[model samples]
Target: KAAYNKYLSDKRAKSTRAYIISQGIDPKRIESAIGYGEERLLNGCDGSIKCTSAQHQLNRRSEFIIVDM
Candidate 1:
């Protein structure tokens, strides 16, 4: 989970920084964004836990926020 979170965080931060720069925001003026991954599961464990790990992982995701600089 930690590794996944780190990976997603890096991904989101890079993407956000690129977008901000592309929109004419100064690179140095912008701070980094953070990604929250898989921590907020929407579906409560419905029925059996027999679903494949890959299925559960599909729920795992990345989220991002822009730092106010």
Candidate 2:
């Protein structure tokens, strides 16, 4: 399960990066795209505990950080 989650996360990150580049953003302007996977759960829903579907959905998301240089 963990491996599958990581794989899905990786695909999501790469897809997001590709979409951004497709939008005319220079590839060089983006430093890197990474997926933390289950390692960075937003809430306490780490499989060991029961959580609502909405809570799990919250953890499945993408975040972008813009850096000013």
* Model 2 bad stretches (over 4 Å): none
* Model 2: lDDT of residue 58: 86
CA-lDDT, candidates in order: 0.61, 0.87
**Candidate 2's TM-score:** 0.90
Candidate 2 lDDT over residue span 1-69, tens digit each: 888888888888889999999999999988887777799998988799999999988888878778975
- Candidate 1 lDDT, tens digit per residue, 1-69? 556766775687678778868999777775455555544554542224566676666555444345663
Model 1 RMSD in Å is 5.6
Worst lDDT run of 10 residues, candidate 1, spans: 38-47
lDDT of 1: 0.61
Worst window of 10 by summed lDDT in candidate 2: 60-69
Model 1, position 61: C-alpha lDDT score: 49
